[model samples]
Target: MSTARILIKHGDVRYRLLKVEAASDGSLICLLDKDPQPLKGGIRVETGKLIAEADLEKPVPYGRFSIHTTGEIHRYSGGQRKDTIHIEPLHQLTKAHAVGYFSIPTPERLDTYDASKHTADVVETLEIPTEVSERLTFLLEIGPKALKVATYGIGLSYELYTLVSRSAAARLPEELAASFVEAAALTVFDSRQIQKDEAELRFYQKIYGQGSFVFRENGGAYVALTSVPMARAPTMRVEFDGSELSIETIPFDAQNKPTHKVRFWIRDKGGRNKQHDLREHIRSVVFDARL
Candidate 1:
């Protein structure tokens, strides 16, 4: 028994092994096995080409066409083997389902096979939305783990800070408002830096105080509290160089100089670990009820 294969060109090119039921007068009808019900359609000769599956090693010659073992359909002219038909395989087909037809590429000899070049062609033919397709391609290449970390871990932290900042701007204590906003912004920045190093899911905690608010790092494992005078809020400056954590508080006085500066060095096994610790400490003081 011979298997039936159909070569189709309908805007997009597709070569698939379909169960062909009948072929006559340049028109063919096939029964789709994958569909729940049989699909019947008249495929004109101009739109499709049908070939019977046979022993590839034994070339089958029918009139002017010959199916060779190399999976090439060769044309005979004046009893001489003429041109070899070249079939391009669909690329990026796995990213999306082939709408009208099942996406399957015919086997070709190693020397003549190159599917990498047709990636753009396949993506264009699918007519998928550009943004959606790009995101899908990125997700496919980067894997789900990285996507989850980006969406949930880093992305969530940013959202939380934005929400807190907005709320703090309206209801936070007047003296601690500046400290709260600054801490929130710095926490968001540091969260992005150390999110990759963090192995477990930990959220920021809020601690309220009279003239200050503490953003507890990674659930209170590390703490850096930002404090100002009860009379007024001072400008706060924070710097972390992977090993040392520094915070300088400058009051709005006549000299306008830093009134208090505190620094802590976090020595660890590696620079990355030290940076991670410092980032956590900075992050811990970003959220508080007073803000």
Candidate 2:
């Protein structure tokens, strides 16, 4: 029930809605709406060896820009041959669905534009910067059940390259032309996917902060001190059995730094007290007279 519009423009050259048809694959087909006649041959671009004679200087008019509908090819008159343009069916149009370009050749001051004039409720027309211009082409993609929008760019590069290369390949069967064209187009899509994956991974890394810690806890209390500034470590605590005057020895080096040999003293003198270092280890420093 939803519909999308495709606009094509190149400088002063502009083409509006031409034709629309229901595709066999459940998607909609569109082209220059003027032409309703059957084409003599397949529609193609004017920038190839077949049209341009491989001559760089010749004007390769836009004849190949065609529309395929109703099992016929409808080509566009490059305006050089014909004043108006027509689109036919059965052109097997690819990457011909969505495209537009904007350019402004005059100074911003000369082009009277007001942001207040912009409104989604209506189709707003604004002049583009004269300094820039571009040509864009797109395709209508239908999934297993629905239609989707796709664009044409680098993929077209490989398509053009393959079309030109295979056309020039010596003694190549014409029947295989379709296969070469597909392969060339696919290679471009694959390369784009790889580049896209890399970009996505980079974005994910930024969102998910790094650095993780994994360790096990013992029954008794344990504490870990990290030398790294501002880093927090884990601490474990184990309670004494029954306020027993039990003592654990903790040894230390001459510099007073506790080593693994260091023992800790735990005495129930009202509350538990732990002193680390063998020198400070709980010993009978003052023998009890009763003992």
Candidate 3:
């Protein structure tokens, strides 16, 4: 059986999750080793060390989305997909329901590769309101390949770190904070030329309306990144108004050009959208962002 170890560097402690896909029950065994163990067994968390003999089985979810064909209802399945997300240290603290990677519900789930060329893509318009909606869309074209989230603390399962960076960010001036994230996103796009992970794009669809990405700038649109706590798989749908579902989804490299460049940024929730920057919303009384 093929074994895989998912290692996370959070704060000062290192946490590892081992998975053996071919296992009989689709469960992961915790090992004392920092890597996946060659033998099959289970383990748990000991006071200040690794606990053995516990079997971890997270549901191997099969994420899929429907396609509107002439008559036949189409469905697409996938290799691996997650339908949730977490902000900062909260995930490390409450690791039970934490989200790591996911798929954006798409008809292309069965496709073996990512979309290299596409002029028209579905852009689900999540109405900007203190009001909630049945459906929302998150365009993956606008974001960092991966967030460089800094962490701290000490623990085996949970590398407990202070949420200082996020909290410390609560003090920055709104406008400056917004500009910084925007510039960094643009730089990552221009330099890396990366596209959103196809699986993540599908997973976002599942978590769409759960959160919203708002801007302090007038006339700016929301990207609906995160909002609902303990994100779960989305199993509902909403009827669209005419043609708002399908819009041109452009890559990040075209963000500054005249072409259609999708844009997104991290910001506070609905009422707190005024706290435009991380430092402006996150506090540093506990722990702070290093660099």
lDDT of 2 by residue, 157-218 (tens): 11111011001112223432321111011111211222222222222232333321111122
Q: How many Å off is the CA of 86 in candidate 1?
A: 64
Error of 3 at 228 (Å): 21
List lDDT for all candidates, in order.
0.23, 0.25, 0.22
Identify the candidate with maximal lDDT: 2
Off by over 4 Å in 2: 1-5, 8-18, 23-28, 33-48, 52-132, 145-291
Estimate, for each residue in 1-291, the C-alpha lDDT of model 3 and write its tens digit: 223232222233333311112111111121211221232242212343433433335422232221111111112212122121112112112222111111222212112211243111221111123332212111111112123233221111211211111101122232222111100001111121212222223233333333323222232322222233212222122122332232212234424221111233333334233333432332211111122
Give model 1's TM-score versus the native structure.
0.15
In terms of lDDT, which candidate is stronger, 1 or 2? 2
**lDDT for residue 92 in candidate 1, whole number 0-100:** 9
**Top of the candidates by TM-score:** 2
Q: The CA-based lDDT of model 3 is what?
A: 0.22
Query: How accurate locally is residue 113 in candidate 1, as Cα lDDT from 0 to 100?
Result: 14
Q: Compare candidates 1 and 2 on TM-score and give the better one.
A: 2
Write down the lDDT that model 1 would get.
0.23
